[model samples]
Target: MEHADEVYDVIVVGAGIEGSSTAYNLAKFGKRTLLLEQFPLPHSRGSSHGQSRITRKAYGSRDFYTQMMAEAFAMTDELQKECGEQLFINCGCLVIGPRTADFLSKTKSCLKRYGIPHDQFDIYEQRKRFPALSFRDDFEFVLDKSGGLLRSDKILQAFQRQFVRYGGVLCDGEPMIDLYPGTIVSVKTTKGLHRARSVVLTLGPWAAKFLPRLGLNVPLQPLKITVCYWKEKHGGNFNIENFPTFTMNGAAGKHHIYGLPACEYPGLVKICLHHGPNIDPDNRDGVENDWVLDAMKLIIATHFPSLEKEPSIVETCIYTNTPDEDFVLDVHPTWKNIVIGAGFSGHGFKLAPVVGKVLGELATGQKPSYDLSHFKINRFFKTKL
Candidate 1:
């Protein structure tokens, strides 16, 4: 493909889930959008790789997320229809935590407020139903019917294809080296210089590197989290029928452990810490730390007794987390034409579809379909004082 010096209506940086979805939405509106990526297409170097991601409307505190999931599900459904492929598989999800914990209580509140069907079970009942699970008396589990697994890579490819079908241009293997934010945002890329009416930066972990230069000081901590898959002792015990995706909360001061049923790798269940060790994305390929690996092993022993002590497959993924763990979605204070989406905090994949539409609306100067107050960039300013 030849590089052309042309001005697009919108320039989207980063071809991850958020960027691809936003580009697709813009192209659907017949806008000349350019999707940019630093790495070549379909590379596992980014956070958006992997076979499946848990997609569930199991927000404990953010009822707004539940509201957004309504639109997200519809949008994903439309994508599946247009692509003639099944990207979201409905396998349900099991959210387990102490009833007294904020996670479980707030989730129940959100479920009731949104009328999302879920079954609340005590620990005894949960242990009986799913014999592979073991929990104490204080812990309660909710079976969320609206949750399922999302084929992330396939979804990205599907959206990219749909965006092109709608006449969108994608420049993969190109990095945005410089950006001139003005009425016409000029972007200098490896391929060539391209101008666009508006720019949306959804660069995931690399967002902070450019955001501060744009007069937006977002304190983002990029952490390298390990994606460990533990082999199940009895393969059928972790099957989709017997096992469901689980999010576990420990007693006070203990971190959370979440896992998905066996699917990606046969006999291996995907599990990872809700938090991670702070590290740079460039050096994320280093050898795994013994302390972290031991901690994960302990978690599996305490929670999932049916899984092996050691992880059969270990991979690395990065997360840009915010202090409050909510997302940062807003326009730059100086450049209204420039929109930013960052600090997904490890739970952004399930909300990418709705977030893309919202980010696209912000870039295009259209009224956002949902309230943007919760995810505004100005919130951090209030905390500084």
Candidate 2:
């Protein structure tokens, strides 16, 4: 027998979007799943809180992600029926960078492979198509027509609700104290000890802390990123109707810049850099991020003249990044039944549905749906630790 008190087939720790999505899939697959969360139902401490997130099939180097995004794009239609709410906004996502930039070329390769209706311009003459900002000849433009914005907070709520409807047990405000791995994985939480056939750790920023005690050393860095929204001088220039989601590579040296249309707030657009300083997830406040604001202002003054130089509203989010910025979607090195889904690295939100499916498959001892060589657990050698 697995365990006398094994009440669930799979236990998912961390009820963030990733964990919630995984629990939803497990419950839908008739797995008797249990989901645990440290915080309350909806909180802004983790990576899934922001109201708007850009959803696109564009990737820099990984075409498998583009394939996964295609699958993810299809799942949104299914999510609408389950949630009964608008989940996605259909505006193009534009990638702005140098023609010779590695990220742009790699992204172009994926776009070309799928024939996703993206156009690349050698000349800086995109004012007719998108007139919000000025373009430079040195920077290349890749217009991804499939790009849009996801109602992030609403999607998170929808996944959790669907998980509950599918017969998944969710316990919030209860943190996991410890986890034991075996044929029957047992998790000790703040309230009580729970046992299941498998455990999935989607701990977000808490991954670096908890993974080590499992005897697995993962290089997951918890970063504190500032999400800023700037106001457009014109009334509706950057709104969802007139604007497109955009990504600017090499904004401030190595870090990149990304933006979404004005949906969360009325006239403010969400444009921020993909960079932040390291921080402890438990203690997220009291960090200095003024330098990020300065860099963003410079970018706006140079490129986005329609928007105000200073941000109108500001917020913060966490990113559990790997050294390579790729997600860690494999199982535990020793315990195959215990799965680890961390290191989303800020860009994992759009792929949560597929990630959850993959984690569920791994938990139930089934073959993965897509190629996972890029997400292998041992990709980062122990020496790097």
| Residue range 198-280, candidate 1, lDDT tens digits | 99999988886778878778988888878899998877888766677777777323668778888888888998887777766
Q: Which candidate is the best by lDDT?
A: 2
What is candidate 2's lDDT per residue for 1-385, written digit by digit as tens? 6555456999999999899989999999888999999998788989999788998997867778888998898887799887889998888888888777898888898888788888787543677666777756677788889988898899999999999999889899999999888888889988989998899999999999988898778889998898999998987778788778988887645458999988888998899888888899988887777888888888888888999878999899999999998899988878888899999998999999999999999999999998888888788995532
What is candidate 2's local distance difference test score? 0.87
- Alpha-carbon deviation at 379 in model 2, angstroms: 1.2
Q: What is the lDDT of residue 124 in candidate 1?
A: 77
Model 1 residue 215 CA deviation in Å = 1.9
At residue 229, what lDDT does model 2 achieve? 91
Give the whole-model CA lDDT for all candidates, comma-separated: 0.85, 0.87
Screening candidate 2 with a backbone cut-off below 3 angstroms (N, C-alpha, C), the clashing residue pairs are none
Report lDDT (Cα) of residue 292, candidate 2.
Answer: 84
Q: Over 4 Å off in model 1, which ranges?
A: 1-5, 251-253, 286-288, 383-385
